[model samples]
Target: MIEKNHIVGKEAQKAYLIGVANRNTPYEKAKEYIEELAFLAETADIRTIRSYIQNLDRPNRATYIGSGKLIEIRTKAEEEGVSVLIFDDELSPMQLRNIEKETNLAVLDRSALILHIFDLHAQTAQARLQVELAQNQYMLPRLTRLWTHLERQRGGTGTRGGAGEKEIETDRRIIRDRIALLKKELEKITRQDEERRKNRGEFVRIALIGYTNVGKSTLMNALTKSDVLVENKLFATLDTTVRKMVIDFTPFLISDTVGFIRKLPHHLVECFKSTLAEAKESDIILHVVDVSHPQFLDQIKVVQDTLKDLKIENKREIIIFNKIDALSADERETLETAWLSKEDAPALFISALKRENIEGFRNMVVDTVRAKHAEKFPNQKLELYS
Candidate 1:
C-alpha cells in the first residue's frame, strides 16, 4: 500500500522533479509542466528540493533521461538529501526499473503521484474502492518492480520457476481478482446512484468541471449554499457531491465532481467513470476557470480534452471565469470582452470567493437551466422567472 505521508521517520520526503522537452514540447511549456508537477508533489505532502529539465529530441529508452543527466541528477539529489525522484510524464515499467536502479532512490511518475494524492483524499466508500481499483490496476503491470527485493534463482531443468517469479505471478493473480471484484462492487453502487438520479427526475442537472484547484468547490458553495470541501490542493474532491438548489422559483440539481488535470491517469479515469457520470448526464456543464492563472487557457484546453475523452463534449457548456478578484480591473475587462466575443459558449466572469457578481452568475445559471428544462420537459408546469 502507498502511504499518504510518504515520510521518512519524522521528516517529510523531499523530491527532485525531472522533465524532458522535445520538439513537441518547448522549454517554456516544459517549465510550466514542471511547475504543475511540483504542485502535485506538494499536494502529496512531498517537498520539492530541485527540478531539472533536459532538452532532448526524445526521451532515453532505458531511463527516460540521458545517462550523464541521470548521474548529475543523482549527485545533486544525494547532495540535497532528496528521498524521491518525480518525473513529469508517465514512465514505462522498464524505465521505472532502470531509473530506480541507476539512482538508487525511490522513483515516481506523474500518474503514481496523482494516485497517491487520490488515495489520501478519498473519503467515501465508493471513492476508496475506486482509488483502490486504480492502484491495483496500476500495480498489476509493475509487479516485477514491486518484487525487486526478491532474488530470482536460475531455473533448473526440473524446477518450475524462481521465488521472485512465483511471488509476482501470485500477486498479479490476486490483483486481477481484486480488479474484477472492484468493478462488480462499483457497478452495484453505480446502479444505486442511477436510481437516485432517476428519483430526482425532471430536475435540471448541472455539473461543475474544471482543472484542479480552480475554485469549483468554492463556486459550488456559492451557488448551492452547501459546504463542499474547498481546498487549494489538487484532487481535493474525489467523490461526487450533489445539492438541490432553487433560484427564482426554478429548482435543479447541481454536482461537484473531481477536478481534472493534464496527464491524468487513464486507470484513475476508468475507475472513477461512475463518479464522473454526473457530468456526462448533466443538462449543462459549468466549466470553471481561474482567470488569474497565467495558463488558464491551457487549463481550459485540458478540461475540454478530458471532456472529449469522456464523450461529454457535446453537452451545453457555460464557461465560468472564476477568481476575477485576483485580476486587475483592466485585465478582467479585457478577458471578459475577448471571451464574450467568441460567443462559443456563455462566458461569465465572477469571483466566487469574494462573492463578486454572484447574482449575475446565479441569473445566468437560472436562465440556462430554465431553458434546458423547458427544452427537455416542455409540458412540465413550473413557475420560473420570465
Candidate 2:
C-alpha cells in the first residue's frame, strides 16, 4: 500500500471532470453543475485539462456513462495527458471499479472530492480525527484495488511472492482494525462534547448555517469581530467555532460550523454528527443564503432538507439573504418581490462582504433571540428601547 505521505505528491496529477445529466436534470442546471465541479477541482489544486458532458436518461449500471462515452473520455484523457478523472455524482463501488478499468486514470466522484477538501481543511485534532474516520469509512469498501498502480510501480521486496501477497492482506486487516479504533475514539469525543454542551446551562445558542461559499465565515467575522480562516473556496470551515456576542447587553452564543452542500455524502453527515450538534442544540438557526446566486432558491431547499435530515426543522430560524451588493438592479427588484411574497419565516437582506444593512441584520437577530429567551425563561424580563 502507498504510505500516507505519498498522497500529497499524487495531488500534482492533472484532472478531467465529467458530468452526466438526464431528462430530470435540465440542461442549464447541468451546465452550472459542471462549472461548479470545475471550480471544486481547481480548489483541490487539480488542473482541469478537459471536461465532458453526456445527456442520458440515467447512468449506465456498469460504468455510469455508456461504455462508448467512457472510451471517448479515455482517449481524450490520454491525448491530453490527464492523470485523474472526476465525476459530478457519487459512483457505486462497482461503477467506480468499472470506470477505473476503462479510463486507466484515478477516478473520483463529487463526494470524494468534498471529502478530500475536508481532509485538507481539517485543522483541530477533533476535526482531523473526524475527517480521518470519515475517510476510512469511505475507503473501506473500495480497498481491493487501493493504489494498485502505485504498488506495481513501487515494486518493493514488500510484495514479492507469497510473502508479499500475505503482507498486503495483513496491511488490509490493519486498516480495518484502525477503522474500528478510530470509530471508538470518535464515540468518546462525541460523549465529551455532549457533556460540555450540557454544562453550558441556559444561554441562548444560535448557529449560522448555509450552503458552502455563501460568506458564512465572513458574516461570523462581522458579527463577532473574530478572525476565522475565510476563503472563497468550498468547505473552508470544517470545524465548529463558537463565540459569545452581546447585543444591547444581551449575551448569546453563536456558532459557525461546516456549511452544507447539495448531495453532501451520507457518510459525512453521519461522521460529523457531533460537529452538527451545534445546530441541533441551538435555540435559533440563522440560515444564510447567497442572494446573488441565480439558484439561491434551490440552495435554500438544500439547506432546509439537510436541516430536516438532522432533525432541526422545528427550531426557530431567521433567513439572512447575504451578498446583496453583488446583485444588479433588475435582479434585485425581482428577488425583492419574490422574497416579499414569502410568508411566516422572518427574513433580512444584507451584504456581508460590504457591511451593508449589517446593523439591521444584527437588530433582527437580537429581536429574535430576545423573544426566544423571554419565552424560555419566563421570569426574566428583557427591555428594548427601540
Identify the candidate with maximal TM-score: 1
lDDT per residue, candidate 2, 1-386, as tens digits? 23332323545668888888778887778888888888787777878877788888898999988999999888988888887888999988899889988888788889878788888788887787788877777766765453555344345443533335555577668778987887889889889999999888667899999999999999999999999879999899998999988889677899999998888988899889899999899989999999887778889999999999989878888899899899887887777778779656778889988999899988888888888888887776555322
Candidate 2: residue pairs that collide: none
**Model 2, CA-based lDDT:** 0.82
lDDT of each: 0.86, 0.82
Off by over 4 Å in 2: 1-11, 149-172, 381-386
lDDT of 1: 0.86
Give the deviation of candidate 2 from the true structure as CA RMSD: 3.0
**TM-score between model 2 and native:** 0.92
| Residues forming the 10-long window of minimal summed lDDT in candidate 1 | 149-158
Best model per lDDT: 1
lDDT (10s digit) by residue, model 1, range 1-386: 44444433246688999999988999999999999999988888888998999999999999999989989988988898886889999889899889988887788889988998998899999998999899888888887542342111111232223346776798779889999998899999999999988888688899999999999999999888888999989999998999988888888899999999999999999899999999999989999999888999999999999999999867888899999999999998888788888767778889999999999999999899888988998988667432
